[model samples]
Target: MVVGGSLGGLAAAHELRAAGADVAVHERSAPRTPAHGAGIVVRPDIEALLHRLGVPVEAVAVELYESRRLDVDGRAVREEAPQWMTAWDVLHRVLREPLADVCHRLDGALRRVRVEGHEVTAEFSDGYTAHGNFLVGADGIGSATRRLLDPSFRPAYAGYVGWRGLEPESRLPGDLRELLSGRLTHFTSDGMQMLCSLVPGPGGELEKGARRVNWVWYVNVAERDLPALLPGRSARRSASFLPPGDVPPETAERVVREAEASLPPALAELVRLSDPFAQPVLDVPPWRMVADHAALIGDAAGTVRPHTSVAASKAFGDAAGLATALLGWTPAQPLPAVALEHWEVLRLDRLVTLAGTGRELAAASGLGVGAGRTFFTGD
Candidate 1:
């Protein structure tokens, strides 16, 4: 059984099935792509896993021929940093389409897990129970499975937040679009970094006029101001993230004011023309990733800062590793404890290394270690 049917959970189920395990994925919400999403730069690990799953990345992705650093006036110094980019929705669709009817049980929100000897069971809030020989927790950062294993788990907010948005290509000002096309652009200033690149539009439309420009601006924000920035109707719901349209009007206005003051002209215009959202950058160097018959994968195991560009790759690698460990274990068989233990030992070390790399990158950029004014408690 797999808990939390996001990218990690879904990938785990797919890989495990290929390894000859009968898997059931339990997701709390309806299976749908997030409306407020960001761009993804395809990395090697994820590219390999997608190919293994027979997905043609080129068909769903856009290519950026160069990486350019821009001045506040929109002047550029270009380099040959070629990359393939895709929208989060497009990739999610590709991964999800193949599992249309295989093993998804939507609305099955996991509430508890019970382990009796070699058997593992998942209990859902909806009063449902599922039994399996082994359980994988691919649930995201706020994983209930991880919490069950270690109640002290908390994601330390890296004193900043990313303001992200998507602006339609057709709507961009003529000169701005001409300058940004076919390039990934970035600008850096005191306590802030912003980047913009072209990505496939809604429905994976990559044509010239149908694409979208995705941008992310990272700014240092004091912890005390979080409640004001994240004013959701329900405090708990918007503590960590505010999806697209949910960003409060005043917060959005403040973002525009800040953008005009800090960003390059073209980049600020992109922010002005888009409906922006905010998500606190967070990290947690996981102390433990496995316990008996259950193991956490993806963000559940370790929350790494996105500066490493390995967020998705690490999750996919975890899925591949877990599946490989269960390669010879067939359906209705006893749990492969020894194989799991070996995988856990290796996985723990790798998770630590990855988390450390993220921290190093964040610190060099002046944003990772003790970056925030206060630790986020999700109050």
Candidate 2:
């Protein structure tokens, strides 16, 4: 059974099914629709995985043939490195379509997990329970599985927040549109890093006029000011991030003003015209990703800062590792403790290194203290 049916859980479900395991995905909420989830840098391993699932890659993705770095004055240099970009909404659809045969239980929020000698059971809030040999927690950063496993573990808010926007290509001024088209562009200043790229449009259309420019700006926010900066939907304080339309209008206006004052002219206009949202950068350190018959993947296991841009790829890596470890396992048998241990060791090692790298990058970028490299590397 997989808890949380977002991209991570869905990826886990797909890979495990490919490895010949019967899988079921339980989601705490209803199915998601596109909320301009923004762009994702496609990794080769992820592309290969999609190919293995027979999902046509190009139809849902846009190829970026170059990368550009712009200064505050809009002066820039370009490199011929090529990478594919896709909207988060597009990727989610493709990953979800292949899992039609798998059981998907919606609104099935997990309440507790029970483990016996060989069997594991998940109890949901609605008084429903499901038994299985193994369970995977691909839930996300606010993972109930992680909390249930280790109540002491809490996701630490990094000293900054990422403000993201998706501006329609047609809505952009001709000059600004031309400047951002067909490339990944980056800009950085003290305590801030910003980037933009062309991604498929709302309906996953990759045509010239149908595309959208996706941008993200990371700026330092004082810890004490977070409550007012991000007013949550409920009385509870905001957790990791806020979705589109959740950020207050005044905060969005303030971001636009900051962008105009600090960012390049074209980039500032992009922010001014687009609807911007914010997510507090967070680091979720994992004490242990594996516990008996259950394992945490994706943000559930650990979350590095977005400066690394490895969140999606990291989730896919976890899914790949878990599927490979359970290659011959079935629900009829007990969970393979030895194999799970091996997988956990490797995943843990990588996550620790990745988290350290994030801190180093954050420091170098002025989001934290100390000196380090600000290079972006893949998972």
Candidate 3:
């Protein structure tokens, strides 16, 4: 059984089912449509996992030929390898179709989990219960499974917030669109940074007027100051806890105004037009990745900072690794402890390093130009 029907849960369920296990996914959200972030960058490992899950790579937009340019104060500094960008909805739409045959119970929020002997019982908020040989919590950072197992674990704020949004390519002026089209561009200043890239829409074409631009801007803000930046009831919530549509009009305007004043012209315009969403960056310690019958994957396991763009790939990698371990499990047997340990070891170093690099970038955001080279080795 996999709790939480988001990307990690879905990927876990698909892998387990492919491994011939009787897998059932329990999602707390309604069954209508999947809720996801603005955009996701798919690295090679994620692409490989999709291939294994029978998802065609061609169906998703691939921005392989273009490069990611890093700039500071409007001056080009560095360039990194190409990356693919796709709307989360588009990717999920493709992933959902293949998993239609799998057993999924939506609106089934788990309230408690009881592990007795070799069997595990999951109690849901709706008063229903299900028993399975092994339970997986792909539930995300606030995982019920993790709470039941280890209440001491919590996400640690990484000292930064990422503001993101999407806009139509045509919405951008011609000169700005030309520079941003078919490429991932970054414009940075001291504590402020913005990244813009184009992704194919429903038509799967990049014709001058055909695609949409996805943008993410990272800024360092104090945790105490976030409340004043939110809208309505969310104003009382912490930066790490704010949900979608929580930014107040005044706060939103402040964010856009700051971008306009500090960022480069092309990048500033993207933020100006963006309906911004903010996420207080955080990372879970390595030890938090382990539990009784389940393991954390993606942001649920821990976030490696967006600087490296490795979160999605790590989640898909976890799914792939976990699937390999459960390939021959029987109903009477337990999941292999050795396999879980192996996965943890494989992921720990990369995550820790990325988190450290993210902190470094956050601390010295004003350094500009040469700063991008310190964390990212490419270009």
Q: Model 1: what TM-score? A: 0.92
lDDT of 1 at 250: 69
lDDT by candidate, in order shown: 0.79, 0.81, 0.69
Give the lDDT of residue 315 in candidate 1.
84
Q: Write the per-residue lDDT of candidate 3 for residues 124-151, one digit (tens) a residue.
A: 9888899987888777766676767777
lDDT of 1 by residue, 1-379 (tens): 9887777787787888888878788887765536547788888767877898887778788999998999888788999988899887887778878877677787767788888877888888888889887888887777778878888988777788888988789998888788779988888775677888889988899899899988888777777777777775344455457778777676788789888987888888889998898888877667566677888898888877777667777888889888998889754667677877788788778888888887776666566435532222243
Q: Which of 1 and 3 is the better model by TM-score? A: 1
Query: Per-residue alpha-carbon lDDT of model 2 for 59-159, expressed as tens digits?
Result: 88889889899999999999997878898887887888888888988877889999986688999987889998788998888899998999887888776
- TM-score per candidate: 0.92, 0.93, 0.86
Ranking by lDDT: 2, 1, 3
The candidate 2 region of ten consecutive residues with least summed lDDT is: 370-379
Question: lDDT at 141 for candidate 2?
Answer: 85
Candidate 1 vs candidate 3: which has greater lDDT?
Answer: 1
Model 3 ranges off by over 4 Å: 32-36, 68-80, 202-208, 232-245, 364-379
Alpha carbon RMSD to native, model 2: 4.3
